[model samples]
Target: MEYKWIALSNTTIGVLMAAINGTIIIISLPAIFRGIDINPLTSFQYLLWILMGYNIVTATLLVSFGRLSDIYGRVRLYNLGFLIFTIGSILLFLTPNTGDLGAIELISFRIVQGIGGAFLFANSAAIITDAFPAKERGKALGINQIAALAGSLIGLILGGILSVYYWRYVFLVSVPVGIFGTAWSYLKLKELGLRSKGEGIDWAGNTAFGLGLILLLIGVTYGLMPYGSSQTGWTDPYVMASMISGAALLVSFVFIERKVKYPMFRLELFKNRMFAAGNIASLLRSFAYGGLMIMIVIFLQGIWLPLHGYSYSETPFWAGVYTIPLMLGFVAMGPISGWLSDKYGSRFLATLGMVIVGIGFLLLTTLPYNFNYTEFALMLFFMGLGNGMFASPNTASIMNSVPAKYRGTASGMRSTLQNAGQTASIALFFTIVILSLESSLPTALATAVTNAGAPQLVPLVHNVPVTGALFAAFLGYDPVKALLANVPSNLIPATAIHIMEQRTWFPTAIAPAFMGALRNAFYIGGIMTFIAAIASALRGKRVIAEEKEEKEVIKNA
Candidate 1:
């Protein structure tokens, strides 16, 4: 294969591996917690950490890593990323301890993997942009992006299948792929992108940005946990302090960057309308996309699958299977839209894609709790199609608009915003769902328990943390069974116990309330996507002449 093809294939593999690791843990979390002997209900903080830690790390480090790639070489850092990722995978698979220690080890190892992911995410687009001509950049990035997204969907399937046998296998699956990718990247990929030499590292800027983001994300993470009498820690002094301090640091970082001779991020790049608009749209789209997928999984596993006769144990796998059409839609449209973008420019296609995605979200809000599979699948496919249409062209516009030397930093900044959006989306969406559930779930649970002839258990069920219930359903466990596990069997009649444990019963009871909260989330997501579409529409046509002019200015300077 030619060098460009080599670069594309290797980076695609790297991104796929990283992306797969990202979501594979979601479906496998139940098995992982079980294997580690951690109760999902009581150890919700650990669950939250496991879910959000990798994203937080990647989001905070992308810009710094991207700038480093510019100073060193994209290929060099990318190769190192593959190696580090492989090592992290091996460590995760070889976890020896059980319980709290094991969970901590896993989370820590995943952070290592995230560091590797940051390197790959920061550099992959820059490498591809360097290899492909401007006209063909969209198509190449489309294929790479498709791999990344398809990997996420594929992870759900793989996690379902692998975790059925052994949770270790979920981490194990990545080992061989990572090894191959690392070696291939080292041997086949070359530094085709321009590198900046003699530019000093902006330690002050990097410190401020990284610390600020870290504090902010940490606050968001803790905000989901209960604090004292409150259902959430948003009012906790530590959380409030973290958010306030983090915001202050970020503001200071921006000022510091403006004054520094060598800044970690090139703030000037946002001056270009295409770059700014593309990044803004990318951020909003990611926020919507990330939260949407989580809600869809909860919808399927918590309500739809059980109503359709699938057991809780089987829901995770079947949910993955049912979602395949969505991935297929993305695969089908991604390359074609990318090629078209090369001809017509990204503004229209990307904006249209966002609009289509908004429509899909709106359609989801109209779904009844027991939605038809065909209709649900169609809506998912449309959303996927829209995302497919938007991702590549927007990425191309961002990369193509920047000068070659700054591509690494630009790519980093883009990934940082996108990843930050995704990380924040989880917290934002979960908080919304949990808050909604808090207001209504207690009354709903009490009514259901009383109706089921288990009125004695109403108080217990009413006090269940909304987050715990959501997590139980998300992990494909029967919430009723979990709640009833502590109740004395003698107090409830046999028939009542049976009814409470029935696959359909709990889902039916919780459906109305869950759907209400979920619909609210969908509406929020839809509104965000609509806003993103507007941003996308506002981006001007790509100007090749402007890029040439900027390149000349850089060379002269």
Candidate 2:
């Protein structure tokens, strides 16, 4: 194989592994929690930490790792990423403790995997750009992007299959693949990009940016927790303090970057319209894409699957199966769109892609809680198609617009924004769903319990944290079972218990409130994609002549 093909194959595997880890836990969380002997409802915080921790770490470290890769070597850091990720996988599989200790160990190990992921994500695009010519960059990146995106869907399937047998197998599945990729990368890949020589690392800038983003994301994470008598922790003093401090630090980081002789971030790269607009579009698109995926999963697993006769424990696997059309759409359009963008520029195709995504979101809002599987699948396919059309061309445009020496930093910045958007999307969309649930859930639960001849249990059921219920459903736990687990049978009739435990009972009861919030969330997602389309349109055409002129100016300056 040619060296470019070798680079592409190896980097694609790295990305696929990282992306698979990103969401494999989603479907497998039920089994994982069971393995650790943790109740999904009571230990909801651990669930959030495990789900969000990887993204948070990857988002925080991308730029730093990217800058380091430029100074040292992209291939070297990328190879190390594979090794470290594999190690994390081994640790996760070998978790010795049970209960909270095991959950903590898993979270900690996931962070290690996230650090490895940052290394892979930070350099993959830059590595590919270094190997492929500018004219062919879009197609190469398109193939790479397909693997990254498809890997998430694939993880859902693998998690469903593996977790059914053993939760440890979910993590263990990555080990052999990581080992092979790590060795292949070390043996076959070489550093071909321009390296920054003799420049000192910008410690102050790195600290400001890293700490600031960490604080802000932590604040967002905790902001979802309950505080005092409130349904959410947005009013907590510590949450307020963290957000304010984080905002101030990020501002300082910007100023520091402007003054640094060897800045970790390349602020000047944004001077090009293509770079700026492409990044903005990428962030917005990520926000919509990430949030949409979570909401759709909840819809499928929490409501539709059960309504369609699938048991609660079976929902996770089938939910993944149902969403396969979405992946198919991406596979169908990604490479073709990239090739076309190489000929016609990114503006038209990318913009059209976002517009289609917005339309898909709008269509999703019209879905009944018991939506037809065919209709739901079609909407998902359109969403994937639109995202596929945008991703590769937009990435190629951003990378091609930068000077060769700055590609590492540029790639890092792009990944940082994309990962950060995904992290924030969970916080943002979940908050929306939780808040919406809080308003109606208590009343809904009270009424349902009463109607089921369990009026004596209404008070206890009503006091359940809305987030606990959401997490229970998301993790494929029967909400009725978790809510009523501790309630004494003496207070409720056996018949009532039987009625409440019916497979469709909880889903049917929660469907109205969930559908209401889900539709509203879909509307918000639609608006985001619409704005992203505008950003894509504002990117204008990528003119090679103008790009050459800008490079010449930067070179002389």
Candidate 3:
């Protein structure tokens, strides 16, 4: 009994850290760029690696490590994750070099942190479910989900504070937490769950899956970059080739899995409709989720908050502050939804939540280019409400359905799908924004800079790459403002400086173009969430999968 609590506490801490760091880098981008002393306009790839590296590493390694946990021991592997994550944090704090190299090194270390995060996320839920009984599992999972949800937002706030004083402090904050978690988990975590052995390492399946997924993800990654005059690079020769090759490999890997004696992914799991349907729903929801966070941050930092009079420097911190509506909504309903799900089943709540989320997106679309606070806050609140309803229950359903022996792999598979979906969403959204910025950003920047009195620098302004948008976003700074700052003071009004620095100027300058891009992105987001709702609704009632006569009858044939 005590062990269950201990397990819950430790897993919660690890997951909390993992979830927080997932986004901690976003709001801290400005500080990071300044610390490293690189012009973000020229540092597009670095920005992508820094932002996407953690996600990509976690997504790629989750399933493999999950399988390893099943064979070795969840507790042993989980504790190792703590140590690795801590070490990564330390290395990040002591990052060497300067400029692009330093940025690259920091990103490299972050990838290591992501690897450790994969270990924690892949097995945390399964470990908790293993410790607790069925009745308590829903409640337990709810708490875990709450920590995850809260931790994400908390990262925004923490990053804002820590980045203000010292950019490295953001990384440093995790060190103490990681050290405690590592030692505590090592001393206290005890694995009592089913552990599979002698699977003899499915090398063929592992290699095929790893290579196939990497190729596919890389295709997705490059697809988001610019491709000569196109807003997006989906048609890039390289991206297209990668996608085609990755698909072929994945298809071949599926065949190899069936023939292998010990396949990492048991193809048979799909035979269970609930598991398959739940995963589909989970993936759909995650797609929207991954994109939504970035969009919301953009809205707040780049558009709304800034328009309302927040400077770029202060935008990151206030962005976190303003997002409290969502946080409040999630906290209020997280446990309640879990309790409701336990009593009434997950399908209704999850589907209903998706409906609410879709509606929230619709409401957001209706807001004028300039909207009032009440409307914005209310919309965000509803968005939070819908998310709160879905996240906890959906997670519980997925975990509860898996058999004990396969929990590690199943959890890993689930996390992989979710994390992968997150990565894909980011790529997709960036593609939309980057494509939009590619054309409008340069034109707008020249006029904006010229208007600010640096007509001589117009050529240089025009030369700034679209990737500048990404760097500006990561740093929580406005690209327009950065461009305008380059204007020679002698050529423009002194007020030009003040106006360019004004919160509303940048958002207003980029408003029409950003709106053009954001509208399409928001619609896509709504559609994704709506599809998830439909998937959720179709999941129907919950019935545990045990190999009973009816199940066997269905399975044997």
Best by lDDT: 1
After superposition, candidate 1 runs with Cα above 4 Å error = 545-547, 550-557
User: In candidate 2, what are the lDDT values of residues 1-557, reduced to their tens digit?
Assistant: 99999999999999999999998999999999999999867776798899899999999999999899889888889899999999999999999999889999999999999999999999999999999877888999999999998999999999999999999999999999999999999999999998998888999999999999999999998898888877789999999999999999999999999999999998888888999999999999888878777777888888889888898899898888899988988888899988988888889989999999999989988988887888888988998899899989999889888877788888999999999998888888888888888878888888888899999887897788887777777788788877877878788898999888888888888889988888788888889999999999998778443359678899999
Worst 10 residues of 2 by lDDT: 540-549
Error of 2 at 280 (Å): 0.5
RMSD of each: 1.7, 1.9, 3.1
| TM-score order of candidates, top first | 1, 2, 3
Off by over 4 Å in 3: 436-466, 478-481, 485-503, 546-557
Instruction: Provide the clashing-pair count of each candidate structure.
Output: 0, 0, 2
lDDT of 1 by residue, 1-557 (tens): 77889999999999999999999999999999999998877888789889999999999999999999999999899899999989999999999999889989999999999999999999999999999988988999999999998999999999999999999999999999999999888888999878999999999999999999999999999999988867788999999999999999999999999999999989998898999999999999988878777878888899899998998989888888899888988998899989999888999999999999999989999999998888988988998899999999999989988888898999999999999999899888989899999989989889998998889987897778888888888998888778878877999999888888888898898999999999899899999999999999999978553468768899999
Span of ten consecutive residues with least summed lDDT in model 3 = 541-550
Off-target runs (Cα >4 Å) in candidate 2 are 543-557
Using TM-score as the yardstick, the better of models 1 and 2 is 1
Q: What's the lDDT for all of these models?
A: 0.91, 0.89, 0.81
Clashing pairs in 1: none
Per-model TM-score, in order, reads: 0.98, 0.97, 0.92
